[model samples]
Target chain A: MKIKQISIFLQNKKGRLYDVCAVLGKNNINIRALNVAETEAFGVLRIVVNKPDEAVKALGEANFVANITDVVAVEVPDRPGGLAEILKVLADEDVNVEYMYGFVEKATDEALMVFRFDNPDKATEILKKHNIKIASEKEIKEL
Target chain B: MIWNEKFECMPAGELKQLQGERLKKLLPYIYNNCKAYKDKLDKAGIKPDAIRSIDDIKKLPFTTKVDMRDNYPYGLFCTDQKNVVEIHVSSGTTGNPTLVGYTRDDIKLWSEVMARSIACAGAEPSDTIQIAYGYGLFTGGLGFHYGALEMGLRIIPVSAGQTSRQLKIMQDFAPKILGCTPSYALYMAEEAREMGIDPKKGNWKIGIFGAEPWSEQMRTEIEQTWNMLATDVYGLSEIIGPGVAQECPNKIGLHIYSDVFYPEIINPNTGEPVKEGEDGELVITTLTKQAIPFIRYRTRDIVSINHEKCKCGRTSPRISKIRGRTDDMIIVRGINVFPSQIEHVLLGIEGTEPYYQIVVDRQKHQLDEVEVLVEVNSKMFSDEVKQLEHLRAKIKKEIESVLSIGVKVTLVEPKTIERSMGKAKRVIDKRQM
Candidate 1:
C-alpha cells in the first residue's frame, strides 16, 4: 500500500539524528519507521509518520527542509531470505528500488518493508505476480 | 642584439626608451600572430598602430593564467608547432595544463639565463654538477642540465630519488654543485650524517635550490649542515623554469633579467601596477621570447622590488625574497592566514623547527577549528611534559594574535610528523562543504 514519507536533510554530525528526532517528539509526531541515507557531510532522513502534513509542518517550523514522497509498504515472510525473495522478484520485473527500509515490528509475524521504486505500477505487478502480500492503505493508516 | 640588452644596465631614461622601441616592434608581431589577442584588442577598441611606445603598451590588456588556459593547448603560441623545438607545461591540477612553447632561440635563451644564474652562485665550468631535480615534464632537472652543459660544466643528470644511491654517487663522483629543492638538500644532509658520511667532506661547494619558495632560515640551516653556499633559483613553468631570476652571492635579492623579461608589481586585488619598491604581485612581460610571448603575465608571487644597482656588479633589477603567493593564502574564519605566517610563529617560539601538520575542520555547523601539530624539541626536557599544555596554549595565543584567528596547537615529538620528499602538503582541510 502507498503511504506518505517525509525526508529530512541532516548534517553528518554527532547528535544530528537525536536533534531531529527530539524536535519531532516535542511536536508530538510519532515516527513510525525511519532510515537515514548518507553521503559525507549530509544525510536524508526518510520518515514514515501517522500524520504526514502535521509532521512536515513541525519539521518545517524547526527550520529544516522537509518534503513528502510516496512509498509502498510490503509484507514479507519473517524468515530467512525474505528480503532476498522480494529483491529477486523486483529484479526480475526491472523495478529499480531507489531505497528500502524495514519498519519497527511488535511481533514476529511478518517483516514490514518500505520501498521507493521508479515505477509503482511495475512494482505492484511484480509483487502480485510473485504472490507477495502488500499491506492495504487502510491497514497502514489504521496501524 | 635584441633591443640592446646592454641598455638594461644603463640609466632609467635610456632603458625605458629601448623598452618602448621593443614594445613598438612586438606590437605588430603580436597583433598579427595571436588571434585571441586580436579579438581582445578588437573588443577593447585598441589599434596596434596607436601603440607607438612603452606607455602605449600599458593600454593593452594584460595576459594572465586564465588567458593562457582559455587559449588552451596551442592558441597562445606565437610560432607554429613545427618551429617549436620544446614545450613545457605548468601543473594543471584543475584542468588543462598551461603550455609554454620554446623555439630554438627560446631554448638558447633559457639555457643562457640558467647559465648566468649558475655563474652568480659561484659555479664554474670545472664543477661536477649533480642535477638532483625531477625530470620528465618538470623543467627543474633538464633546465639546469642544459644550463650546466651550456656553461661547460660536467653534468650528472641524476634526477631526484634514492637517497642512498644519490649519496653513493655524491660520495664517489664528488660533485661540486648540487642542484635541487632546498628541502631535499636538507633531507640529504640529515641522511648523510645518519649514514656516518659527512657532506662537508665531499667536493660539493655550492647548492642551488628552487622550484619552491623557502626562507633565509632554511638556507642558513642547509648551509650549516652541507657546508656549501646554498642559493635560491626562481622561475615558473609558464615562463621558463629555475632561471627567470636567481640569488647572486650577495644573497640580498634575486637579480631579474629585466632586459629579456620586463617586470611590474601590481596589486592583486586592484590589478593596477604598484610604484617601485611597493609590495604586490610580480607580473612579467617577455620582451624577446619568440614562441609563446607573454605580456604582463600575472605571477601571484608577493615581493617588493629594488631597481637600484646591487653590490654584485650586476645592474639587473632585483626582486626581494618571495614571502609567498596570493593563491597560497588560506581564508579561515574570514581571515587570510598564510602557512608561512604559521611557520613564522612556530620558528619565533623557542625550541623547534621540526615537521608539522595543519588540520582544518568545521565544528558545530558554522565554526571552523585550526589544529597546528608541531614537534617538540628534545631540549623541552622530561620535566617539561607538565608544562606542555601551557606551552601549547601560549603558542596558540601567539598564532591568534599574529594571524588574528584562534588555533589549537598540538605539540608532537621530533620527527613525529610525516616528512615529504618534494613540496610538503602540510595543511589538510577536513571541512565538508
Candidate 2:
C-alpha cells in the first residue's frame, strides 16, 4: 500500500550530492529512484532506496539531516495517456498530489511512479478502488 | 527603590546648575594637568575660563578615540601615575586599544554608579549576583563585582565559560541575579536545557545584560527562556564600565546617571548635535571622573535620548537602546544597513530562531550583494517545500522593505550558525571595501 522514501536536507554547496552518495555506497545501500527538489539556497534529496532505514542511519552518521517518509508507488502502462488518466482519476476523487516522479522499467513496457499526496492513506485507498496497479513495499524493494 | 534620590531625582534647573559648576572646574583641571587636552584646547583657541556655563561646552574641543590611541597608555591621565590605582583597556578590535586609568576615588564612584544600576534593574541588596563577564582586563566582570559588593549583595565572581561549573553554581548557589552579555545569557539558557535543567524553573530572577547591541526580540527570547527580567545595562570601558546607565524595570529606556556622565546625541558625519529624540552618535562628558575625564568624548554608539520624565519617576534623561555603532553600519549598494535590523525582521517571523548571519560580498568588483542565513526551527523544517519557499520569500520581502536593498535569504538548519559565549558575531563582510 505504501513505500518508504528517504529525504535528506542538503545545503547548496559543491560535492554535497557526491558526499551523500559516497556515504550510502560505502554502507552498501542501493538507491533505486531519486529526485532532487531544489531552491536557490538548499535542496531536498528524495530517494527511494533498497533499505530506507539503513539509508537514514548511514546519512545521519555522515552528519546529513535525513528522514524517512511514506510515499505511494504505482505501476502505470508505458503509454502516452497513462499519466493523464491517473491525474483525471485523482482530480475526480478530490485527492491532491503534492509531488510525483517516476522511472521506466527496463524489463517491461511499464513505468514505476512515486507520489507524495496530501493524505497517503486516503490516496492509497482511492487508487485501489479505481483498480490502479499499486506497487507494494516488497515490489519496490525488488526493483 | 531609587538610589541617590538627591541626584537621580534632581530637578532640571538644579541639575543644569550642578553641571555648569562641574564643567567650570573640569576645564581648568584638564587645561593645567593633561598635556594632550591642553594642546587640543590651545589649538582650538580656547582657554580655561571660556566655559562660563553648561551651554558653553559646545565651544570646547571634542575628544575622539583617536586622541585616546595617540596618547596610548597614560598620556590622558589627568593625575599622576601613582595616584592611578587601576586601569582597563578597550578590546580594540580596530586599531590600538585605548587605556583608561582609574583612581581609588574613581573606582569608588564606579561602584556606586554600578550599584545604582543594579538597583534600577530591581535587584535587592539581599540577592546574590552571579557575574559571568570575563574577569581580567575586561571591565564587565570587575565592574559588576565591585558594584554588587558595594550594594551589600553576596557575589560569586565566576567569570565566563566552563558551562558545567556555571550550571552547578546556578543550581547550588541559587543566585537571584545574573550578569553577563545578552548573547552569553542566551547561550547559557541553551546549555542548561542540554544539561537537563529547566532555566525557567531556576532561582534566577533578574539578568543584567550589556556590552553589545541586541534587539527587543532577543530581550523577549531571553526573558521567556529564563523566566526572569532581562534588563539592559549600558556602559563602555572608555566610560566607567557597566555603571554609566541602566534600564529600569519598566524597560522603557536606560537612565543615564547624568550627574556623573552627561549624554548628548550628535550627527556622526557633521559632528553637530541633533534635535532631541533624534537618532545620532552618543557623546559623553564625565562630570565627576577624576583620573581621566573625557569632555564630549565621541562614543560612536548610535542612539537617541529622551529627556521626558520616565514612568520609573527618574528625571534623568534616558537613551534608547543602542541602534548600532556608527562604524558597524554596513553600506550595501549605497544603502546603510544594520545587522540588528535584519535580526529584528528574522525574529519577528514565526518558525525562525533568533539566530542569523549576514554575509555581504562584492560581485564583479562593482555591485554589492547581501545574503542572510537564518536558522530554521523544527516547525519550519517539517513544513512542505512550497511552504518553506513561501517562508523564504516572505523573509526576503520583509528585509527588502526595511533595508531597501534586495537580499537572498537562506534557511539553514538549526545550530548551523556559530554561537558565541561572548558577543555573538552577526556579520561577515567578504567585500574588499
Candidate 3:
C-alpha cells in the first residue's frame, strides 16, 4: 500500500520548522509522523499527515515550497531485529531505500515503519511475496 | 566589417607616433587649463615639455576616481564651460558622483568609436537596433542610440523595464539587433516565452551585451536561448561610455579603440606596468577628449590585453572580457554590491554575528540572485522558529534598504563559515560568468 507524504523545502534558517507547523495547525491539519533531513545550506522537512492535500495547500498558502511524494508503510514485529530483517529482504531484492522513519503502535507488539524506496511498486510486491504486513492509508491515518 | 580601416589598421609605429604627438599636445592643454593637473605636475617637478614620447606616459602622475570626485563638476574640464555641450554623471554609490563633460568634438568622437563598436558586433546599416539599456543618467542607452544613428541603422530606443511591452515591440517591429545588459536579455527571453513568443524563432540576429561582467557560460546560454550571436561590449562613464571597447563577431576579446583611447595594464597594488597579455588593472588615458581628458586614469577593472592582430583584421589592441573589479564591489543583476554594505546591515541587527558571506548565483531563469549567509549567536540559533524567521526578515529588510537590492538572508550556525588565516573570503560567486 502507498502512503502520501509531504516534502517541504526549507532554507537552513531559524523558525522554518515552526513555520511549517504553524501553517498546518492554523488549517487544523495534523502531522502523523515527521522527520527532518538536513544539509549545510538547507533541509527537507518530510511528514506523513492526516490530510496531505490539505496540508500541502495550507503550506503552499504560507509560501512554503511543498511537494507530494509517495511512500510505503509496513508493520514489523516490535523486536530487536525487526528493522534489520525487513531491510535485508529489500537489499536482497535489489530495491534501494532512499530514507525511512517509523513509530510503534500503542496497543500492538508491532512497529509501523514508513519507507521511501527507489521503486515503490516493486518493493510492495517483494514485501507481499515475503508475507510482510503492509499498512494501508486508513491504518496510518488512524494512528 | 572594420568601420575605420585607416585608424584601426594603422601600423604600430605610426600609431605610437600619433599617440606621442597627441600626448605632447594634451599635456600642455592640461597644465594650462586644469589647476589640479598644473599643481600635481608642478609638485612632481615635471614640465609639459619633458614628455617627448609615448614611453614618457609612465612618468606622468596617475589619476584616480578620488581625484575626479574631489574636483567635482567642472574642475577637470580642459575646455571652457561654454564649449562643453553635454555632461554625464556616474551613479556614485556614496558621496558625490563623478561628472564627465563633453564638447561637440568629443560627442562626435564618441559616436565615431561607438559606430565602430556596433560594426564590430556585426550590425549593418540595414538592420534595426532595439536599445533596452536605461536612459537618462546611464550611458548605455544614449551611447548606443547616437552610435546606431551615426551608422544609419534604424533605431528603436525602448529603454529598460516593461517586459511585456518590450516583447510586444520586439515581435511587432522585428528588430534584428538588441542592445542591453546580458541579464536583462535573458530576463526578456523568459518573459517572451510567457507571452507565447519563442525568442529563438524571433527576428533578432545579434546581441551586444555589457555594462556588467558576465561569464562565457552566460554567453552560451543567451546564444542558445535566442539562437543568435551574443557578444560583450565594455565601457564605463568615466571613460567614453560603451564605445571604448567592443567584442567583434570572432568572439575572442573586445577591441579597444586605441587611436582615441590609450590603454595600459598595471599592477593595482604597485602601479607598475605589467607585461603584455598579463592580467592586471586597466588604466586608460583619453587621447582626444576635449572637455575632461584623463591621463592614465586607473579604471579599477581587472583584465588582460592582447596586442596581436585579430582575425577581424583590426590592428588595435584587444582586452579580455573583464574578469572582475579590483575593488570589493560585486555586480549583481547589474547593480554594484559591496560586502561592507551587507556588514553594515548585519552589525545593526541584534541576533547576527560579525561573520557573514555573500553568495551570488545565476538562477535557471538567467537572472542573478544574491544570498547572505549570516552566522547568528547561539541564543538566536536556538530560538523558536518564528523568532528566527523574524530576524531573517529584519536583516533582509535592512540590507535591501541600504543596497537597494533584494537578497535572501540565511541564518547559519556560529563558526560554520570557514575562517581564513589572513584576508577573509567574504564572497562566494557561484555564477560561472
Candidate 4:
C-alpha cells in the first residue's frame, strides 16, 4: 500500500518554518513525521501528517509552495538483517531508493520502512508479492 | 585602537603642496597619453601646463565615474600598457564598467597603506584576520586580501559565502578580527544563534565592514550583539579599491590618504572648492599614481569635511562619515531619503534581520507609498500567534520612530529576502529616471 505525504517548500529564513507551522496548527493538523531536505536558500519539508487533506488546504490558503507525493511503507523484523532481506527483495525487483527513513513505532513484531521511489504502485506490488507487510493509511497515521 | 597626535598636526597646506607638485607632472602625462583627455582638454581650451597648482584643477574639467567606464579596457592608462600589472573593475549594472590599472609600485603602496589602516584599528601581527569579502573583479575582496597579507597577519582567506563555514573557521581557529560586509557579519551572527553558538563568547574582537553606506544606529546594534567593535573601511574600485581612507580609533570620521590621493570638497553648484567643514561632493586627485592619474575627478558622494587635527597622528584631512551617494539619493513623497536611513532604523530594532528592501509605488490619486519588507527573525518566534503579530507591530513602531514616516511593514520568513550573489538591490523606484 502507498501512503500520501505532503512536501512544503520553505525558505531558510528565521520566521519561514514558523509560518508553515502556524498554518498547520490553525487547521488542526498533526505532523506525524517530517524530514527537512534543504539547500542554501530553501528547504523542502517532507511531512507525513495525520490529516493530509487539511494540510494541503492550509498550505494552499497561506500561499506556501507544497505538493503531495505517494510513498510505500513496508514492515521489517527487528533483527539486524531484516532490512537486508527487504533490500534484497527491492534489488531483485530493480527498485531504486532515492531516500528512505524509518517510522518511529513498530507493529506487533516489525519495524516500518517509509521508502520513496520513482514508481510507488510498482514498488507496492513487488513488495506485496514477496510477502512483505505494507502499512495502510491507518497504520501510518498511528505510527 | 589608540590615536596618535603626530598624524593630526600635519597641516592641509603641506598635503596640498605635494598634490600641486604631482599635478604639475600628471597633467602633461595625461594630455600626451590619454586620447579622451587630450580631446577634452582641447575642447575646454586648456593646456597641460595650465594646471600648475591644486586650485588650477578648477580650470580643468573634472572626470566622472562614467568617463572611466566610457574608456573601458585600456583607454586611460598613462604608463606603458605592458607595465600595467593588474586591473580591477567596478560592478556596473546599467552601463560600461570602470577599470583601475595598477603598476608594481602602485600595488606595493596600496598594501602598505592598507596595513597602516588595519594596524590603526588595533590589529597586530600576532592576530589572525578572517577576510570574508568576495574575491576577483570586485575589489572589496581582493583589495583587503592583499592588505591582510601585507600586514603580516595570519589570514584565513575564507572568501564570502556559506555563513556556516565562516562560523566554523571562527570557532575552530579563533581569529581575533573579521573583515566583511555589515550584512554578512549580521548573517554570520544570526546563523551562529541558530546553530547554538554564542558569537559574543567567541574569539572575534572586532569587525571591519564597508562597501555600502550604513547608519550609527546600526553600528550600535552590531557592536552590542557581537560584543565586538564594528569599524568602517571606505573605498571604491575607481579610487583604488578598499584603501582610500579609513576610520581611526576616534570612531568618527575617516582620514584620506592625503600623501597619495589629494582630497577636495567641491561645491556641486559652483564647481568650485568649498571652505573647510562644509558638505560638498568629494573630488580626488591621485598624486603618486603612474598607471592612471585622476585630476579633480568628481566622485558624487555627499559628505561634510573637517580640517582640524585628529587625535590620531596621521596628518590627513577627514570627511564626516559619508552620508550617502549623491547619485543614489531617492525622493519619496517629496522627501529625500538615502536607503541607509531606513537600514539604520531596522538594524537598531531587536529581533529583525539586517536584510530588507524599499519599494516606491503610486497609490490612489497618484500618491507614493513606501513599503519596507524586513526578514523576520526565527530565533525569536514561537508557537504563539500573538508573538508573531507583536514582532510585526514592534518593527512598524521602530521604523516609524526613526524615519518619521509610516511604512507598510511586511515581515517575511528567513531566506525570503531575495538572494544576490553580488551587489545587492535594496531599492526599487517606479519613477522614470
Score every model by TM-score: 0.65, 0.60, 0.68, 0.58
Off by over 4 Å in 1: A2-11, A36-46, A51-72, A78-101, A115-124, A136-138, B1-21, B31-61, B69-76, B91-96, B126-138, B154-207, B216-230, B267-273, B323-433
Cα error, candidate 3, residue B266 (Å): 2.0
Flag regions of model 4 displaced more than 4 Å: A1-143, B1-11, B329-433
* TM value for model 3: 0.68
Question: What tens-digit string does per-residue lDDT give for candidate 4 at B1-433?
Answer: 3223343345768667767888888888889988888988999999988887876867888888667767776777788888889987653322234578889988887786677667766687768989888777667777777787887889888877778888999899999888877756766777788899998987767778777565677677778778888888877666687878787767868877777777788888788778888889898888777788787787788777777767766667778767656576554432335566666666666756667888877532233567877764444433223445577678778766555456787655545456688545788765321
lDDT of each residue in B1-433, candidate 3, tens digit only: 7788999988899999998989999999999999999988998889999999989999999988778868887788888999988888764434455688889998898899889999999998879999998777668899999899899999999997788898888889999999999999988999888878899987878999998898888899999999889999988888788899999999999999888799999999999999999999999999889899999999889999999999889889999999878887787765567687777767777756668899999876667889988866543442124445677789889888776668988866445577788555799988766
Reference-based lDDT, residue B360, model 3: 91
**Highest TM-score scorer:** 3
Task: Indicate the worst ten consecutive residues by lDDT in candidate 3 chain A.
Answer: A102-111
lDDT tens per residue, model 3, A1-143: 89898887666778879988989999898887788876556666788888999997887677565778789988877899988999999999999988888753421468877898868899999999999888888877787
Model 1 per-residue lDDT tens digits across residues B407-428: 8777653344676785556788
Residue range with the least summed lDDT across 10 consecutive positions in model 3 chain B: B378-387
* Cα error, candidate 2, residue B312 (Å): 1.6
> Which one is best on lDDT?
3
* Alpha carbon lDDT at B373, candidate 3: 85
What is candidate 2's lDDT per residue for B1-433, written digit by digit as tens? 6877888889999999999899999999988999999999999999999998888988987898778868887888899999999998753323345578899999999999999999999988889999998786768899999899889999999997787899899999999999987767877777888889998988878999887666798798889999999999999778788888999999998999998898889999988999998999999999889899999998888899999988888989999998867776564542446676787777788867668899987642134679999876545564257877888899999888777668999987556677687555688878542
Task: List lDDT for all candidates, in order.
Answer: 0.75, 0.83, 0.84, 0.73
Clashing residue pairs in candidate 4 are A13-B414, A13-B415, A14-B378, A14-B414, B4-B312, B4-B313, B7-B313, B7-B314, B7-B315
DockQ of each: 0.02, 0.13, 0.02, 0.03
What TM-score does the first chain of candidate 2 have?
0.95
